[model samples]
Target: FGDGSFTGKGLYHVDAFEAALKNRIDENTILSHDLLEGALSRAALVTDVELVEDYPTRYSVDASRHHRWARGDWQLLGYIFDPRGVPALSRWKMVDNLRRSVTPIFWVLACVAGWTLLPFTQAAQWQALMILSLFMAPTFDIVNGILPKSGDQTPRGHFSALARDTVFGTALVALKVLLMAHLAWMMGDAIIRTIYRLFVSRQNLLEWRTASQAAKGGNDLGAYYGMMYGAVIIGVVGLAIPVLADSTGAFVAFFFAIFWI
Candidate 1:
């Protein structure tokens, strides 16, 4: 559903109350509800209204919900790509949702590809690539550091300050990434399963979980591993493949697999 309505903060968090049921919405699904609502409302009023949700307490529960959401978002591919009479804005909304759902899949694929090609790359090439990647993560910070303090349009010495800031920023980024390791694994888990159900197994595309269903007894590593076994397998193999390679591919893939553990 294409519309100009502004959904506050998050579409799931807040939106208009009034809604109309159409005979058929070209774009439809659990994830597309807000977009469809916005499309039908035709510029509904927006107030500084706060909506609160009694979300589940368990992290696994939350992950389960998002996993379902990932499927719902991927289901919109047909509507997004089809040349239908749907509004352009609606198509774009679907595209955005699809992009979010598909990014993790692409990330995992790239990881696999990187590992597969690692054996062919020279040691110098792989080493340089690794160094360049680390530096590129803080490219913006490096660029900002080029300019000294205000009114100090003076020439910087050999970009020393910029280089220093880049290294520090990259370290901070690496730390932040490590902290969110669990989240990254969960996201990848959701999308991979979404794709499997959507195209591989061709089941559970519309299956959703209630709060009660999502609730877990407690945190159990074995049970956790059961649900996230795919990520685990990928992580183990991803690391093994790089280490097995002769080049410095291990350095390139270490960060990718390290957080999974």
Candidate 2:
């Protein structure tokens, strides 16, 4: 590709590589395309190098390094590529992710403290602050983007990105809170829909048509029974929330919300 030049061949090759990667990865994989793209975009922005136009410099790094050093470079790239690895809590990578996510929570707490000390503060204001803290979970993503644990050579750019991500993550969490509140208000409908689909609809459309006729000469009681039974199941789910289950749910929900939005 023009000896690492960012001309015709190099640009085409870069695009092809990215496209090929998109085709290869499973949509459900822990290290997803979205995560990779975000990481790379931040990398490029922080490095002050366009992936295409800056190819020469990066290739120079590759060329200058000892053959053995390639392993470390590849490992860092691999870690960034893997979702399971990027946000990994058991390693150094997690330290940055946690730091980024927690920064906003700390900021919010500081604000709450100031508010508490204010002469005009009241009980209602404190209650509002408590509700606001619920969205702290999403703030981590902002922190991750801004202060990525995967330290490359972009400290100044990282802080700038961190500031940007902090604002964006806060906005995203605010929107999610609104959506969750809406969904929670209609939590009964969600329960009903789950019951109908899982226990009622399938039976009615397939085997239960004949069974309903034989049992009562008319309507199928499975839907009603299923709905009743589902409530119990949902209640069990509610009970599971007291321990590790809720924490897991919160992590999942935070990511799911971020991805969809």
Candidate 3:
């Protein structure tokens, strides 16, 4: 009973794991924990496995690791859907696995889109709902952090870290979503082609890439903070403009400006 780092002998019993790898056709394709988990689930071996908490102490390393994981997940989408390689799982299981893999991308998109559209729509119901949802999300995370048996111990700098993560993490995710969306819009074909080569064409998928330069060694710290602070300002101004000036156009313009940053 263990997480993806399971090095014990029990893993050898999961025939689907080896089958998935062999079916890949390309021997050099990089393997990921998600792929193994999906394979195990598809083969009905999930119940036999156990998971444990493994948290990273360094934020920079964790960010880099997550970036690699996201890329691996995107790449796995191609293999899972391809008829040639991955062993066929039940339709329901396959769909569920795919959904789980892309959950993060969907979440970021939803947050960005919701915030961007909120001003223009001026829907009070939606505004209330968004506020409640955002508040609940972070509150839940904070509660989870302090809960007994949770992976993350209460940090020594608990309040500061919690506040920083809540604000910076939201800003960072918004920026990432906007960047990815812009790239997709501007270089849709090129991006698609690259994915095809890496996954479908059996090109090597083991390259390491940094997710954000700003996250590395506090490089360009000023610029990063400037952007984050700017986002906060824009969000505040966007909401305030509508109430104070009673101008929908002003509210929308400021809201849209947030994405431009």
Candidate 1: which pairs clash?
A: 1-90, 2-90
Predicted structure with the largest lDDT when compared to the true one:
1
Q: Write out the backbone clash pairs for model 3.
A: none
- Ten consecutive residues with minimal summed lDDT in candidate 3? 1-10
lDDT of 1 by residue, 31-129 (tens): 435554455544445467677778777767877777666666666565567624556787777678667655555545555556556553553364345
Over the stretch 1-261, how does candidate 3's per-residue lDDT look in tens digits? 222322222444447566655544445464344444444433233466676855655444454455455445455555566645344553334456446445444443444444445554654344345445545555667667553454475655666666776786577545454443222222333235447857477664665644445255554656444433534453455445455655443444454445634
Clashes of each: 2, 4, 0
lDDT of 2: 0.37
Quality of model 1 by C-alpha lDDT: 0.59
Q: Each model's C-alpha lDDT?
A: 0.59, 0.37, 0.48
Write down the TM-score for model 3: 0.45
lDDT for 222 in candidate 1 is: 81
TM-score for each model: 0.60, 0.28, 0.45
Give the root-mean-square deviation of each candidate in angstroms. Answer: 7.2, 19.5, 8.8
Better of 2 and 3 by lDDT: 3
Model 2, position 86, has a per-residue lDDT of 37
Pairwise lDDT winner, candidates 1 and 2: 1
| lDDT for each residue of candidate 2 in 189-214, tens digit (9 for 90 to 100) | 43343335434563221111222232
